[model samples]
Each structure stands twice: as C-alpha cells, then as structure tokens.
Target: MITEESIQQFSKNCENIFTQIRRDVIGQQEVVEGTVIAMIAGGNVLLEGVPGVGKTRLVRTLGRVFDMPFSRIQFTPDLMPADVTGTNIIVKGEDGNSQFQFQPGPIFSNIVLADEINRATPKTQSALLEAMQEHTVTVMGVSRKMKEPFFVLATQNPIEQDGTYPLPEAQMDRFMFNLIVPNPGLDELMAIVNMTQKTMAEVAEPVCSGEELLKMRETANQVPVAEEVMRYAMTLCSATHPNSDCASEAAKKYVRLGASPRAGQALISAAKVKALMNGRFNVAYSDVNALAAPVLRHRMKLNFEAIADRVAPDAIVKMIVEEVGTRFGLNPKKEEAAAKAESKKGLFSGKKA
Candidate 1:
C-alpha cells in the first residue's frame, strides 16, 4: 500500500528530477511536465512539435532523470520491423554448437525516444504500436516482455509531411495524450542563452529508480474516483458525436469520428493519477476538466470542414468541455448554448503558438 508518506516522497523525488531537467531545458516547461505526467501514469505519449524545438533534448533529459536505459531510434521509411524489435541471431556457443538467441532492439529499452516517428513506414510504426499498448514485443512468433516502467515518447514533425508515413486511426488511439511543444517565449529564449553561456550545472540526473517509478504508478491507479466523475468523463466523450443528441455544436459540424469508449477508460485512469499528483485523496471535477484536452485530442477525428475551416482538435475539445459543463447536474442544452456563444465570440480565434 502506498501511504500518504510515500506519496510525499514521490512528489519530492519528482521535484528533484524536474530540478535536474530544468538546468538543461530552459524553456518548454509544459512539455517536460506533460512527459513526467505520462511517465508517472504508466501511459505513452505522442509529442507533436516543429523542428528545432528541443524535443530530443527533452527526451534525453527525461531518460537521464529516470535513470533508465534510454534508446533513440531515428525512424525512416526504409526501416524494417526487425530493426525496431531485434531478430533472433545465430550465436555460436562455447560448446561449439550454434543456437538462436533473441537480441533485443531499441524497443526493449526502458525509455525509447522515437525521434521523427512519422518518418517511419507504417510497417515499422506498427511494430511500436503493440509495444506501446502491450508493453511487450512479439518477435519470430514469440512474445517477449519488456522492461518494467517502459515508456515511448514519440516526436512528430508537423511541418515535414512528405515521405512520412501517417499513423493510422488505430495506432493514433494508442497514445494517451498528444502534447504539442510550442516555441519558447522571448524571456525563455534569453534564459536559454544565458544558461548556455554560463558554466551551469548539468541538467540530467536520476532522482528515483525504475522500481520506485513502478510503485508510484501503482499508487496512482489506486487513487479514488467517484462514480459521478466517471459519468462526467463518459458524457464528455460521448457528446462529441454528431448524431448523438449530446453532440456539441462544434463537434456536430467539425468532427468526423467521435472518441471511442477507450477514451472513457483513459479519462478515469488518467484522472485518478492526476488527482494523486495534485495531492488529492479523491478525484474532482476540476481534474477531469483539466485533462479533457489531452485525453480527447488525438482520439477525435476532424473532417474536411474542420480542415478547411482550420478548426483544431483543441478547439473541438474546448467545445465539448463547455458543452458538458463543469457541473453535470444541469441539462446539456444549456452548455451547448454556452459553447455556441463562446465560439461566436471567436473562441478558436487566437493563433496557436
């Protein structure tokens, strides 16, 4: 049992890890925090960012902080499945007999930085989908268990689409969150320059071992979520469908495919972890609200109208949140009306920086 005292210890350990990571990463605090959340929750993440945003550096710093065997796989179109999951090699034994031994690939590492994951062919990308979801690899018709506390942080170059294989809907749904790493602000950039100019302390150190991390995740799962909160999460996901009476105005017009019931499961699972992270014994409505964007972003699909209208997934999530309202006791129509009014006020107006 993870007691309150251990929870405090986990928080302290995470702070130390963040302290080490911040030394090297001057900006992108949100990205680093999201990565930590996913890792602690035992969920995989897809980081979408433009080039030169230090996505790789974040993963490297994370690997160092967790004190795990980190591996980087530069995904390419020609990459094969065997390359990601190692093949059985014929090793010569000392007894002069040759036998097949499974040599693990990068996917076997505790932390895998799938750099430019979209650049890999679908076949190679499919290889990872199983590992990300099941935390195991099936090679040569044999299933091999992965190391405990395994996590995959995959980065995608949104600007570079050509020659890149797009992840299908099934594969995309495997990710718990799609975090967008934006460019740093002016002050953050200045801090980066100054930090680089000085003889600063190194920004990569392990604060906790793999065993401790697995324990923390187990504890996170144990956090209590009320039946009402679970119902709220379900309503939020279900209301995104256009045909459903619960559909939000934006979802009806812009969304093609609504989120699956797995999203409902993910919402509650993640919300439980989030509550524990926030030092709460029980999950709250605010916890569910805060997680709506990340939970629903990648799971929902945008149609041609949305693509032409430039409606983003975040925008759709926001509409759903407003439609569902912070308090689910009221009728759904009121919130749907509120969502329309917000959009009319140009809710999705600002440029996504």
Candidate 2:
C-alpha cells in the first residue's frame, strides 16, 4: 500500500531529478515533463524534432539524473536485428570444446536511447517492438528478459526524410507518448549557448534509484479517479475515431484512423502521475485534458484532406477534447453550482415554474 508519506517523497524525488536534468538540458520543458511522466508510468517515448534541438541531450540528461545504466544505439539502415538484440557466438570452452554463447546487446540496459531511430529500416525497427511491449527479447528460439524498469527513449529528425523509414503503425502504438520537441525561444537559445560555451557541460547527478522510481509508479497507480472523470477520458478517446458516435466534426473530416485503446490507458496513467505531481490525491478532468496531445498525436492518423489543408494532428486532438468536454458536461464549476442549488431545494420539493 502507498502511504501519504510515500507519495510526498516520490514527488519530492521527481522534482529533484527534474531540477538536476534542467541544469544540463536548456529548454523544452514540456518534452522533459512528458518524458518524466512516461518514465514513471513505465512506458516508451518517441521524440520527433529537427536535429540539434536537444532531443538526444534530453534523453542523456535523463539517464544521468536517474543514475541508470544507459546505452545509445545509433540506428542505421545497415543495422541488423542481431545488432539490437543479442546474438549467439561460438566460444572455446575450458576443455577446448566450442560452444554457442549469447552475448547481450545495448537493449539490455536500464535506459536505452534509440538515437535517429527512423534512420533504420523497418526490419531493424521491428526488432524493438517486442522489447518495448513485453520487456523480453526472443532470439534464435531463446527468450531473455530485460532488467527491471526498462525504458526506450527514441529520437527522430522530422525534416530529414529522404533516407528515413516511417515507423510502422504496429511499432508506433507501442509507445506511450510521441512528444514534439520545439525549437528554443530567444532567451532559451541564449541560455543554451552560454551553458555550452567556454566550459564543459554540467552533468546531472542521480537523485533517485531505479527502486525508488518503481515505488513512485506504485504510488501513482494509487491515485483515484472519479467515474465521471474516467468516462470523460473514454469519451475523448472514442471521439478521436472517425465517424464514431462520439467523434467530433474534425475527426470525421480529417482523421483517417483514430487513437487506439492504448492511448486511453496512457491518458489515465499519465493523468494519475500528473495529479500526484500537482499535490492532488484524485485525478481532475484537467489532468486528462492536459495530456491528450502527447498521448494522441501519433496515434491519430490524418487523411489526405488534412495534409492538403496542412492540418496538424495536434489541432484535431484539441478539437476533439473541446467537443467531448461539452458533450460530457465537464464544466466543474458549473456542475458544482448546480449540485449546490439542488441541495438547497431539498430532495422531495418540486421546482417552482
């Protein structure tokens, strides 16, 4: 069971970790927070941005802050499946007999940075789907389990698409959050330059251990969500589906495919963590609304019309949230006022017309 003290401790630990990471990583606070939330939720993250936007730096900073064994795999077209997972190699035994031995690869680490993940071919990208989903790799009919609290933070350069392969849909769904790393503002850029100039970059110290992270996950799971609030999450998810009963007009017009059930699960898990971080014991409607974009952006597929109109997935998700909130009567202040009025009127009294 998670005690109040544990929850408070978890939040404090995460705050310290974030503070340490910020000492190195300059901007993109949303990206950092989304990654941290996904980490606590025990989910994989897909980061998309132009090169030199500090996506890789964010992942590396996170690795240092968590103090976990970190590995970076620079995915390339020629990279094979065996390069990601382990492969069996023949080795000489003490008795001079040759035997096959399984050598672990970079995926065995606690934190893995799949740098330039889209640069790899589909065959190479598929290699990670298993480990991301099941936390295990099966090679040559042998199955090996990864260490506890495994996380894969992948980065892709959006502008350089000539030699890149789009991530397969199956593999895309395996990620919990697909965050867009925006370019830094003027002040942020200045800060970045100053931080890097005339000295070695500061290194993030470990603020918490892997065990403490797992405990934080447990505490986040204990955050209660009201049934109405949960229903709002479900309704928002279904609304992303084109032509569904709950779908918004934009979804029907522009979306080729809606978000998956995994998106709904991500919303709840992330919302719970967000609530705890905000010092709340119960999830509020606002928490789910805040996380809808990162949780749904990659999940929702846009149609040709959307492309022609230059409509981004983020816009469609925002529209869906607005439509769903209205449909589900999610105005908290208004609802609370109505409840107060009802209580004042008494249970059996008839309304005066």
Candidate 3:
C-alpha cells in the first residue's frame, strides 16, 4: 500500500534528482523528465537527436545523480557483439595450465551509455535485446544477471543516415520511451556555453542510490489507477492499431504498424510515476494524454504515405489523442459548458421567432 508520506518522499527525491541534473544539463526539460520517468519505471530509453544536443551528457549526469557505476560504449560499425557482452579468454592457471575465463564487458554496469547506438550493425545491436528486456547477458550459454537499478540510455543521430542502421522493430519495442532531444533556445544556449566555460566536467553530486531508486519504482507501482482511466489508457493504445476495434482515423490513415502490448504496460507504469511526481495518489486521464507521445512515437511505424506527406509520428500521435479524447468525453466540465451554451443558443432562436 502507498502511504501519503511515501508519496511525499518520492516527489522530494525526484526534486533533488532534477536539481542535481540541472547542474550539468541546461535545456530539453521534456527529454530529461521522460528519461527520468523511464529510469524510475525500470525501463530503457532511446534518445534521438542530432549531434551535440546533450544526449550523452544527460546519461553521464544521470549516472552521477544516481551514484551508479557508469560505462560508455561508443558504438561504431566496426564494433562487435563480443566487444559489448564480453567473451571468454584463455588464461594461464596457477599450475601453468591454460583455462577459459570470462571477461565482462561494459554492459555489466549499473548505468550504460550507448552513444550513437545506431552506428552499430544489426547483429551487434541485437546483442542488447536480451539485456534490455531480461536484464541479463548470455555468453557461451551462460547467463549473468545485471546489477540492481540497471538502465541502458542509448542515443542515436537522426540527421546522419549515411552509414547508420535503423533500429529493428523488436529492439525498438524494448525501449520504454523514445524522447527527442531538441536544441536549446538562445537563452539556454548562452547558459550552456557559460557553464561549460567554467568547467567541462560534470559538477552534479549524487542524490539517489540504486537501492533508493528501486524503492521509488516499488512505490510508483502502488499508485492506483481508476477502472475508467485504465480502460481509457488501453483504448488509446488500441487506437494506435488501425486494425483494432478501437482504431482512430489518424491511425487508419497514417500508421503502418501500431504499438505492441508492451506499450500499454509502459503507459500505465509511467503514468503511475507521473501521478506520484505531481503529488497525486491516483492516475488520471491527463497523465495518460501527456505521456502518449513519448511512449507511442517510436513504437509506431508510419506508413509510406505518412512519410511521403511529411507527417511525423508526433503529429499522428497528437491527432489520435484528440480523436480518442473526444470519443471518450475525457473532460466532462468542457462538455457541460458546451451543452449549456447550446441550450442558450436554442432559447435565443426561439425568442427571435
């Protein structure tokens, strides 16, 4: 059960985390918040942006804020699976006899920064599938569990596609949120430059630990979701599938592939955390709507028509939210005001007659 005291503590911990992150990161508040939400929800994040947008910096800052063992894997085409998951090497034993010993790679860390993940080949990329989902790495038919509060914060360049490989759907589905890191504005840019001038090192201190982060995840799991809100969340996810019974018009027209069942799971899980962050004890429709874009964007596959027409996934998600919200009567207060205005209009027409 979740107590009020626990909820207050969760919010305070989150505030402290953000305060520490701000010391290193300047802008891109939405991306930062979404990354934090996914981390607390015990899910992986896929960050898409152009070069030099603080994607790598955000992951580094998070490692410091969480006070976890951090490792950086600069993904490239030449990178191999063995380089990431490590391999068994022959070593001399005490008696001078050679024996096989396992050497763990950078994946065996609390927080891993896979910078420019798309630069790696599909074969190399597949190496992370098991670790991201099962939180274990299998090498030579042996499995090793990841450390507590494990997270993989991967980044990819969106504009450079010359040698980059697209992330497969199976791998894409493993991510909880695919956040876009937009460039900072004029003022934020100035602030970043000024801050960097002082020191190139990350100055943020650790405010949360691996154990505390796991506790936060446990607390978020206890935040209750009303039946109607739960159904609505499922409906929104279902609407993404054009072939589903609850398909929205936008999905029917633009989407080629809808989000998987994992999307619904992620939606509710993240919404619970969002509610707790807002000091609410229960999940609400607004929380689901606010998170729909980040949760569903990368999971969705836009049709060729959408691509040719330059209709981005974010725009399609927005349209789907509005369509579903209207059908579900998401806001009763607005509906009541509209009904009252219609009644007054009818009365005025009767007086004119």
Candidate 4:
C-alpha cells in the first residue's frame, strides 16, 4: 500500500537523481528532467539533437547517478541486428565438447544508450523494438528477458539525414517521449566552458540504486487519476486522429495518421509521474497538456499539404491543445475563455487559479 508519504519519498529520490545529473550536465534542463520522468515511469525516451549537445553525456551521467549497468551502442550503417541484440557463439565446455552459448549484448543492461540510432539500418533498429516495449529480446527463436528497470535512452542526429535510415512509425511509437535538445544559451555555454576547462572533471555520484528506481516506478503507477482527467487525456489523444469526432481542425486537415492507443497509455502513465514530481497526489490536466507534444510528436504522421506548408508536429499538437483546452469541464471554446480568465487573475493576484 503506497501512501502519499511514499510518493513524496519517490519525488525526493527523483530530485536527488536530478541534482547528481546536473553536476555533470550543464544545460538542457528539460531534456534531463524529461529523461528522469520517462525513466521513473518505466518508459524509454528518444532524444533528437545535433552533435555535441551533451546528449551522450546526459545518458552517461544518468548511468552513474543511478548506479546501474550502462551500455553504449554507437549505431552505424554497418551495424547488424545481432550486434544490437546478442548471438549464439560456440564455446568449448569442460568435457571438451563444443556447445552454443548465448552471449548477451548491450541491450541486456539496465541503461542502454543507443547513440545515433538513426545511423543503423531499419532492420537492425527493429531489434530494439521488442526490448524497449516488452523488456525482452528474441534471438535465434529463443526469447531472453532483460534485467528489471531496462530503459533505452536513444539519441539521433536530426541534422544528418544522408545514408541514415528513418525510424518506422511503429519504432517511433515505442518511445514514451521524443525530446528535442536545443543549443545552450550564452550563459550556459560559458558555464559549460568553465566546467570543462578545469583539469579535474566532475563525476556524478550514485544517489539511488536500480532497486530504488524500480520502486519509484511502482509508486508512480500507484498515483490515482480522476475520471475527468483520464477522459481529457484520452480526448487529447483521439483529437490527434483526423477521423475521430473530437479531431481538431489542424488534425483533420494536416494529419494523415493519428496516435495509437499506446499514446493514451503514455499520457496517463507519464502524467502520474509528472503529478508526483509536482508533489500532487492525483494527476492534473496541466500535466497532460505539458507532456502532449513529446508524447504525440513522433506518433503522428502529417499529410502532403502539411509537408508542403512546413507544418511541424509540435505546431499541430499545439493547435490541438488549444482546441481541447486545459479544464475540459466545459466546451473547448468556453474552457479556453475560462483559462484566459484564470491567467489574468493569476497575473493580477500573483497566484494561479
């Protein structure tokens, strides 16, 4: 029976993990925080950024902070599925008999950093699909279970497209969040320089173990969500589908394929972690809205018109959020008006409504 006290402890553990990660990572708070949320929610993350934006450093730091087995697979054009997963090798037994032994690959670790994941062929990338979703890997017709609390924090270079294989729709949906790591601000750049210029490099200290992380995941799942809020999450997901009744104009006009049921599951699961992080006992509509872009961005596929007009997935999701509103108690139009009123009140009273 997890209680509010346990939830608070989980939140504290999250903060501790964050603090340790910040010791090494200079900028990209959103990336770090989103990664933390996804990890605690027992979901994988896809990070898109240009080279040298601390994407790999963030994963390495997280590995140290959590004190888990971390493996890095530098995906390349020639990387094979067997390289990502493991393959059987012949080993000589004590009795001088040769037998096949299953050699585990990097995917079997607690934390896996699939660096430049797009560099790998689609066939090789598909090897991770089962591992990311089911926490198990199949090789040579035999299925092997991964260690508990397995997380695949994959990174891809958005600027490089030549000779790179684009992730299929199904592969994209396996990730819980698709976060974009932006270039650091001037101050952050200066801080990065100062931090790295020193002869001594900072190393993240372990604040939590793998067991504690699994416990946090369990606690996050125990957080309750109200029926209205769950419905709001579902409605937001359905609105992404152009054919759905709740579809927004942007979705109906621009989107070709909407998010799947996994999107709804991700919404609620991540919202629970978000609420717990904010020290709330129950999920909130704001949590769902805040996570909408990352959760749905990769899940949606735009049409030809959207591609011609240069409509990004984030922009489409934004329009849908505007159509759905924050409260969802009243109609979207009325809810939008009410939200504006609340914002004005918060602005005037120095307190949010």
TM-scores of the candidates in the order shown: 0.89, 0.92, 0.93, 0.92
Q: Which stretches of candidate 3 lie over 4 Å from their true place?
A: 331-353
- lDDT tens digits, residue span 65-134, model 1: 8888899999988889999999999999999999999988989999999999999888889999789888
lDDT of 2 at 281: 86
What TM-score, to 2 decimals, does candidate 2 have? 0.92
Model 2, 1-353: lDDT tens digits are: 76979977876787687778878887676788789989999999999998889999889888988978999999999999899998999999999999999999899999999999999999999999999999999999998999989999999998887999999998999999999999999999999888889565667889878999998999999888999999999988899898788888989999999989999999999989877765678887777887888999899889999999999998898788777878887774554454334323321122210
- The residue-by-residue lDDT of candidate 4 on 48-74, one tens digit each, is 999988898888888899988999999
Best by lDDT: 3
Q: For candidate 2, what's the RMSD?
A: 8.4
lDDT of each: 0.79, 0.86, 0.88, 0.85
Candidate order (TM-score) = 3, 2, 4, 1
Give the per-residue lDDT of model 3 (tens digit) for 88-108: 999999999999999999999
Q: How many backbone overlaps does candidate 1 show?
A: 0
How many Å off is the CA of 44 in candidate 4?
0.6
lDDT of 1: 0.79
Q: What total of clashing residue pairs does each candidate reach?
A: 0, 0, 0, 0
Model 1 lDDT, residue 217, Cα: 81
Deviation of model 2 at 37, angstroms: 0.5
